[model samples]
Target chain A: MSVDLEKLLRPVDTPLPPYPPKVITLADGSKMVVRQIGRDDIPDLLPHVEALIHHERDYYDIVSVRVYAELLAYYRYRVVDEYVLIGQINGELSAIVNGRIYSPEIGMSYHTLGLKRGLRIGAHCFAAKMEYHIDVLKQEEVLIVAESPIGFRRWMIEYNLEKKFEIPHELGGSPSYSLTREIFNRARGSLIVGSRPVPQDLLDEAMEKILPPSDPPKAPPDFLAATRAKYDSTGTSIIADPKRKKVSHA
Target chain B: MREVYIVGIGITSFGRLEYPLVEIASYPSVVALQDAGLDTVDHLFVANMGGGRINHQTALSSAVLDHLSLWPAGSETIENGPASGSSAVKLGFQAIASGMCETVLVAGAERMSEVNQLDATDFVATLTHPMAEQIYGITLPALAGMFTRLYMEKYGVTRRHLAMVAVKNHGNAMDNFFAHVHTRVTLEGILDDRDAETNNPVIADPLHFFDMCPVSDGGAAVVLASKEVAKKLGKPMIRIAGVGQATDTHAVHERPDPTELTAVRLAAKRAFEMAKIEPKDVNVAELHDAFTILEIAESEEVGFFKKGEGHLALERGETQLTGKIPINPSGGLKAKGHPVGATGVAQVHEIVLQLRGQAEKRQVKDPKIGFTCNFGGFGNNVVCTVIKKEE
Candidate 1:
């Protein structure tokens, strides 16, 4: 292939400040390490993310498909200014977050996918992605959009995101909702979590390899599959979390 | 009077059921019939709390019997607040015990989730005294919070004890396939840690998020028959040895001692006397743990532990899956979920399962006696049942 043709196919990549990896204690007192991963790690991450494409509820199907494509673009050097952050619990993939630096002042949030659903895995991972935009790279705002009602509720409503309806997002023309530094700051103490240094052993294990998700979210059997979604709709029903997932499913 | 025995038990897992309120009752009716290998019963007792109020359907048993194609059998709806389940059991027991019917099916169900949370809470709040409590917006959690506060001060039970109850019940529920609660919450995550505040915020003062049972939609049933009928069925012979129901002041404010669940005490005493057994004879028990505090308080009220020492026993690992008198192995209301009308019947179903040695993973050690106390309206109205394994 000609150098000119290859250059035409891939957009120019911009230098991004590296994200400092951190760890957070989960509800069960287990530690989860949230750190950056590169395109080279996609081979390990793809098959796992691919497995969640059928989690029909909470729009995980569409989200997983979009996430798979975004990672593929990153792998082929087709997307510009892209960064991927992986959340691991003892070397297994828990969540993956990706976003891109759109310009000097603005950012584009691509997707946040959780192979594991509860324990706020996606919430924690989404916070890390926003942290990259408004805190790490110091972008003025990150354009965000939600494909699922859960995402709409958790991200758009929970964060009180501003409607940047005038702006279109990369995930297609769902008018974007934006997370500003002020909005990010307000949620930092409560929503944003995890600690830096990540305990050397935890970091060593997480970086050694992106292992498969131990219990990945699967297609709800039939349509009315006994799901964590029903189990999660309220607090008293919170028993549907995976610890009880087996009994509930069985 | 003839002795009544439960020859068949059936239950839909205690959680959300999108089915109509009637189906919640009928689905398990069919299962109970199948379990007994009986196509029909002489009578059916349907227990429900919010059918008319929440689901906009009244005369529930009529609908259930018709739906199950068990028409022409005598049917009635028994409504007794949250005690509807066991109250239905009592009626079925009476039917059999009086020789009015040799075989009866008592099914309990509630579609409480059909209404939104606020309306569902309001529907249940209707159980409170209208002028004294309901008019003032007194929800169950608010009432339990006050009760827990006074009990805590009097008994020195701490937040740790409540968290311990939540933790233990959650773990127990993991083994119960039909239990409503699933997650295993640690004390560190929901209590002692930095995120605990946000994670387990105070639903009521001293009663954190995990303190209360969830409002669920489910159904459970037991086929009660005469001893001869039970023996003929050739299923496990678990006798409904005793049943005791008692009511107190309709309003908590009217009671001489707010902390004492006198109804629970009296009801349990009556049940034990009738069963010819003491509280200590009960090898496995399921106390109503609608709020985590109730598990501690009811244990004392029912004589499982001395007053003020229920938490001590809880701390000593007495309530674990293999504890001395494992309570709420079905997870009680806290983890198993409380589908108001269905809970009491579900409790009796659990004890029957335990007595019959059919309670799979959450089974207690070999035991002869099991007891259940279904506390209703913050202990204003209570029903206690004792079931013994008949060798």
Candidate 2:
């Protein structure tokens, strides 16, 4: 249940400096605070993942638990450079943003399916992941390289992410697009990265330290029902404002 | 106002057919033309709700007209979801009543089985509010199931009461040769059928598969002609005495009560007012029984019974073929199959059959007046038409 991400981040260890947390104002005037993922944030992150899956049911095909385990293992054991952020509203996790620093050698393995196919799919995927990486890259002044699947070359054009070149004979028939720091920065302003500015190196380190060193977690029995029941009964409410008066800035 | 009379009515088997979209519609259109004893028609109104999504084809009216070799005449496609058939009928009625055309052929066709069940479900779900319901995985059946549960909770109705509706409709459909699914389904058979493969499995919660209508592929056509032209055709005519169409809010959440279909009540009121008769005046009625529970709900909405009494009526066999004011003697959508766009027109075709006293075994005895309730998007839009046998 515990994860130590410090070791993975040790390579890029720098003094933790003060930075404003990302704040997203919801339609209901509720504000969500975004910060880089930490070892103690699993419980907070679980609900967001569940909600996302529930919302995307009719739209996207999600990966299986086995695939998710593999991705987590790869991040914990293999990938030492990545980024992760969790958004919290009223002290409860509301969303998650995660990405890895992709090299041509490592980029050929991301699984894609269903509506996520097509050439541009890779670029969009890469852009999404890279945006998270940039959130962690804050003040680091480090160059990052990532590859997008073939067909996603237009994604390179749209984001103005310069194509370093394409990889041949990659996953399926899709090619890969390589992006550098300069192009990523140009595309950064247009993308809604939300409120988080963790160093990508720190996120990568944290993920590596926290992942289980051995086999995957055991399959939970009726986990969905159990979780839903727990949510219903807990009656725990996140307090937003102590005062009854609504905050007005007009 | 110019009087419009239905000179011809043609309906294909109200069940699954192996024919393609164009073929299904063509059969009924040809039959209607022959029934009307007409070599030509001035305008054609094609009614289909799912062809755009199921068949991936738009502008289907032209496609059907071209396929039937009735081209060069004005053709239009009318879609009001499941009520497309009734909408087409309204359009045709208006065309002739306005003196724009002497003869107008209205055809309703739907081929839903071609698509996979999940895809078909998703397509139907799109009729709901995209941001609110669709995003939450709410579907038509899910809403129907909710309404069924609420109706039962509020009215003390049991599942057995709902089962009687399917049993009655299926038995009635057995007498209907064109019925898509006709079999004697018992309350025990429906409640105990656990195997999804053998019995109609549960689609949405509280709604077993048997409780829902089949995704049929069929068509029905009615030829509307001016009174002069109908008299010359020398066929038994069914006078469309009154037609009323009304609308309500599309969002189910906005409605005051989910159990009662307010639009149906309003439309039926208008139709009865126009016809200068009451619900008692109609000899028979063909309601939109897309689901077993819908029949119960619609019956009350149409003022056929007191609120919350529809279930009791079905349980007592009051809505059966031999019952008072027989509902769905043509097997209804539950047994006859619901081809969406074709369902409303098929209701009209059944009323015509009842009025003409030609419904064979399922015919209501001495039927003089008939009523058809065609609904769109769960009572968001409704059209009720009253027809009478002409002397």
Candidate 3:
């Protein structure tokens, strides 16, 4: 069967928090710029999906770009209260974390996508999703699933998510675990989440316990470049706005 | 370190094996033990990098060891990408040197033919930096193509020079019964036969299918023993005079010079120094020739020729069977076939045969000193070993 090249190449847009939301400064001196997915952000999220599908083909049979485009379109117009978060360093889209509050009781199903180099930026995306799910969605519980043991386990331990139960072998073979609000809060005992707000401390402690000691942390070059580009663009947008210019002139 | 010698070496026909991966591995491991005249062994080190990816069989060492009924002898699997065979050799050497075991058996096997071409390419590319290179659609052949292009531009080496390495290896392979592609090709056959139906088409730019080694299924093994044990069990011996290994940066872009393999240089230097000999002392060399240009580049890196003069050496037939130094007397990987992990030990197996004067049709006469270089990934890690015929 002939493959549809465009369908294979199209990108998927991830869900994010509402734009211009209150920003939180992570303990590691990094700021979490949480915002909702937008039509304009489609271009920014496109390259990541393209790269992810291309890179992860060995692990998963990638869907067509048309499918991805359709998903993005569906998320934009049809999915209410669901959005994509583009995690940025400076202002670049280093990673994309998307999810929706499918139900107030059931919480959200979210996925994080980025280059391995952008893992740190992806962390912000994860934290943003967690914050949005916990505070914005205000759900009683939030659950996260990851294929890799290291990533999944780290998320569980970092966010105090409980290792509920592993999915059966028939479902993708890779294990899946969940965490509830009670378990998450218990794991974060005595350490106030909102008061401390040190993302680095949490990341470092989690990495030390979860990741192999010999393995060095990576900051993907492409992720940095994308984040820098986004930051530059955001700066330019603010400077060029007619309303902002008028205020400045006054 | 204690003195070590390869008392026995075993190699299956280096062409495609129709059997399963375990069967392919079993053949040589059994043969090596038989050749060494040992019914039992203390330790087993199996070298296979692709079995898991190709056949979805992880824990190959235990599988092979269990198949051979050599269970509970501290069997371990070693994987260092393509150079896995040599890495196993290193491990066996260390075991004997550390006085942990008096005798050790190391076997390397791979079955790449089972998978489709695209999947095989993806599997090999997994050895590269996942995010930087593989994600960017860079295949191993692409890297070889780039290296060939850069080497050609820098040294004024022509495609004909690269083709010469293929031609000579194929000619040499005509005598190597174990070689996969034995059909000899003329320079015209390479350059003019661009018709996709007739000729081996170029897989990557500047690299024809013929210029590349085949994705083969084969296995090879060698029995290592301490000098004391070797003397006692002596059938015929090839002393492991020296061994060297070195690693460079993982990413290609991080390398200082793409054309140069510093890992090879350092490994060879250490090997030669430990052997107390220079490159000229080596009578035969089975350097890693996964790609044709690799043979030329590795030759220069090992100090066989000046940086830019490797192509000239190949042009002059200096590396031919009857030339000053015969390279890949068992047709090398280019002709013999590269089963990834099996390649390095296969090289040693060929060298042992040459050193023992048992390489029937392709023997390097009066071969005294021999060498083998095993490269892992894209020159990221390398191991070089020097073997001398026992007087």
Chain A vs. true chain A, TM-score per model, equals: 0.86, 0.41, 0.52
Using DockQ, give the best candidate's number: 1
Candidate 2 ranges beyond 4 A from true positions:
A1-250, B192-201
Per-residue alpha-carbon lDDT of model 1 for B104-210, expressed as tens digits?
A: 99999998878766788899999999999999999999999999999999999999999999988888888887777676778887777765655566878989878
- Report how far residue A182 has shifted in candidate 2, in Å: 56
Shift of residue A51 alpha carbon in model 2, Å: 53
Model 2, range B236-288, lDDT digits (tens) per residue? 97888889999988888788887778899999999899888899888899999
Q: Worst 10-residue stretch by lDDT in candidate 1 chain B?
A: B192-201
Q: Candidate 1 lDDT (Cα, whole model)?
A: 0.85
Worst 10 residues of 2 chain B by lDDT: B192-201
Error of 2 at B348 (Å): 0.7
Every model's DockQ: 0.17, 0.01, 0.01
lDDT of 3 by residue, B138-252 (tens): 8899999988888888988887887788878887888987777656666655553322212344578788776788778789999888877777675676888889999998898
Top of the candidates by lDDT: 1
